[model samples]
Target: MTNKDKSHLCWTIAFSVGLLFSGRAAQATLPIELEVAMEPGSSLTAPQEWTRILGKMNLSRVRLRSIRSTDQPSVTHVQVGKSTRYRVLAILSHRDELILPKKHFRMQDRRKLQTYFEQLPNETQRNASPRGRFDLTEKQFRRLFTELSQPVSFATEGKISSEVLHQLQKKLTLPVVQTPRSSVLLELSLRGELQGLSTGTALAIVLRQHGLMLQPEITRDNSMQLTLATYDSQGDAWPVGWKPEKSIRLIAPQMFEQLTLEATNITFAEVLSQLKPRLKVPIVLDHWILTQREIVPDQISVKLARRKTFLKGALNRLASQARLATEIRIDELGQPFIWVTQFGKDSPRATQ
Candidate 1:
């Protein structure tokens, strides 16, 4: 049998974290016993790929041990009375894994978005005022475009402030200018919901990828939510032909469900539809791994686990806020595998 086949026999008895080298049939003995201890706080060398494989396996606890090679041991065997247990056996070794270290991680400013939007010329004001009159020059248009480049930030604790709304009003009132080439110039302003450079920029990048020009604004009615209202596009509402510049970006569940797209790509639409299913679901951070454990038909046991972790901003926050626990089982083969399950005090229930 292969090395993996022999390991399964050891696994049936207890957790084995190391390898077991087979000896000649003549050297085999009865009732071998092994002792194990852990090297605390060890980390996994390859976390994501490994963990993804582990999660599908559902087990109660995982055991890990450390050792040198199993071929020969300085301390061979120990005896108690008439019985002797192998004092030097193979051990399982585990690498430590990372988790969310704290409560929350957020970026972008909602109050700022509110202020930006409040300043914009609303439909009512525009209706009351005359159109097609201009005092703004090309330099002023460039200034407005430059203003669009500021990143958005979000709040973690409370609602956005009214002061942010006032600021938006001021920024939105800049003079609308007509270009020398006669291409219509409408000042576009967007108020951001989430805060932080990555989140804000991701959203902005996505909007830009979609071919729509946006400026930031802030409002307070919604907390932990994304609200997109086309405040102004030129002198009109959001126009056609504009597409978001970035796709495949990260979003919190709150916003994930709220956001919508007008795209025709079937695969992309499928992904969005999955994100917005009516059922309230766990926000599977982009790098979520699923794993499973089972007995194979062959006597040679195989235990497999999958792992996935991403370095995106939202994931960084999740890692900062999470703690991971893993359970594992060994089979006839010396292969060590994990059963990965996640638990949280505030964890959302799994959805259908």
Candidate 2:
């Protein structure tokens, strides 16, 4: 007979003998003794059974080893050297021919093994589900796709944001632009097809991947408009192509009041330098127009008597004296800034 068969027979006889003596134990707490004969290539079934029984009692590996050595033959004789009972049982349950490494018996590895065991039933159920089947009909797929507005399913590999925007614009027949030149570029590949999703939903996902978001707005003519812009945690502060309205109602009256300036025979440049910080608002100089006109800011002289006036009135008076025009333009964030240009020139439009 094989060595394993012989070991199994020995273990059976030892366990039978131990059962008879177990009834006459001196104390209930004392462990039962089994006189076992072990050899190389011994049957692993006995160890697996003992592991299950001992595990139920929450015995540590060291305690289990002490019990086996004291009450039975040395486990080393069976050619399974120093393997924990739990590890032995795990290997036997999986029918793995190769022995697990010693490091695999660590607490982290044990928890992973437990997790695998727990997930097995759910995995089996998923495998048997209809959705997991590979035999989906073309008609069924078409019907599934149609149920959700026939979403434009697309997959790209390592494409930049501009290319993606172009593709989205063409597919949806809408204009898309990256407002700020510093917007993030997307460089990723999608593995699986997005099934049964809407066009808006798919677009949102793609934009979110690149740190962007889609904002919807209604125009004065009651038409829907879509814009893709950088996301702000505070709110939708920046929409790519939209401009805020410039109206007196939108500006606080206090912003234009309680401003004082008095400069005689001083350069307009010096007066403006002082007024900018006092107003605490952004001022954009039309350098392109000034360059074209060959106007020197310091050469232009200004004379203003000491008086308190509204910011707008002061700025207009200063501009008229300097032969320049001023316009108030609001940005995407609904914040206003001053734009200075030559007189009788069309104001520059905000870029999308």
Candidate 3:
């Protein structure tokens, strides 16, 4: 018998003993009495089927309650004395009926389930997390945000949309899904390059060219995923990018720098093309607004009296006359640009 073997055995014994006692201590976390309210139209099976897993997770005395679908949110209204009770907002799994936040979890994997359950937030801090139509846990969303902020370069390289989609699937960490694969999105061979842009920003631009939008949704238990879907004017979708953290004045000083301007009988499009190089940022038109309003930039004339003003100031007057709005927004990578959109909406056209 070696002294080294004895030492290893002693450490293993200590760890086993510690884990056993810790599990016992964790047993009092919540009252055994809990209710699993099945929201209306939820595909989940009878709540009684959850008994075995709930028992394994130490939630034994769970009751079932059927609910009616309503415009109001489904929040459990239970009182557990002076202590706070967690309001969990969960979606049932379509395949195999396992609850999410339980990654690759099988009913037989009780030890792993117990370990994960034990690591959850303490009773007081376990509040419900919901935002917008699609929601991810706060911790999960933060992780997704951090990953999207990484800078990357992407080029179409004459590949069809389907090929491009496959390429994106390979490059991104999240699973990419394109539903009903549009003939245009699948067949159109796009040509463009987005260099030194955040992954999310680059993807949004690339997808826009195909008339599709990049939507991050909660599907997998471990991570939020990306979906390529047709743009919906009424639906809530992810933004093409975000407003820069830095002030607009600092990020695009060139656009704000004073310049003397005089234009007589020149079309707005001509002026924009001439000023594009000076702005040092891309000037993008909301195609939706232009197409819907039947606005042709070349046909709209601009006549400005000689004055000392910045590019954005002049642009504001021109956009206002055409019933358009100009906003400076940043991409996920913090690159500033001018976004021209329809005037009626208070927010950017790209966002909800």
Q: lDDT for each of the candidates?
A: 0.27, 0.45, 0.59
Q: What lDDT score goes with residue 207 in model 3?
A: 68
Ranking by TM-score: 3, 2, 1
lDDT of 2 at 231: 54
Candidate 2 segments exceeding 4 Å error:
1-246, 252-255, 343-352
- Note each model's CA RMSD in angstroms: 32.5, 23.8, 14.3
Q: What does candidate 2 score in Cα RMSD to the true structure? A: 23.8
Q: Can you write out model 3's per-residue Cα lDDT over 98-170, one digit (the tens) per residue?
A: 3434354445666775665454433223334544344556676677767777765566546676765565556
Cα displacement (Å) at residue 297, model 2: 1.3
Candidate 1 lDDT over 1-352, as tens digits, reads 5655544433432232222212222243333333332223333332222222222222112222433344222123345697533332222234432211121111123344233223322322233334321222344334433443343333421233223322332433332222322121112232222233222222322232222323322223211112232222342211111122223232222222332222222332133234334322222111122111221112222221222322122222222223323222221111122212243322122211
Best by TM-score: 3
TM-score of predicted model 3?
0.58
- Report clash pairs, candidate 3: none
The order by descending lDDT is 3, 2, 1
* Tens-place lDDT digits, model 2, residues 1-352: 8766765665664455445444444432212122222323534454444333333322222122212322322212122365212222222212212122221232224555444433433333333335411222344333322332334445533455455545555655334445663244444432222223344444544554455566643333323345666654443322211134545436534446766767788887777787877555555555435655676677999887889988777877887687787766543334455656674423234432
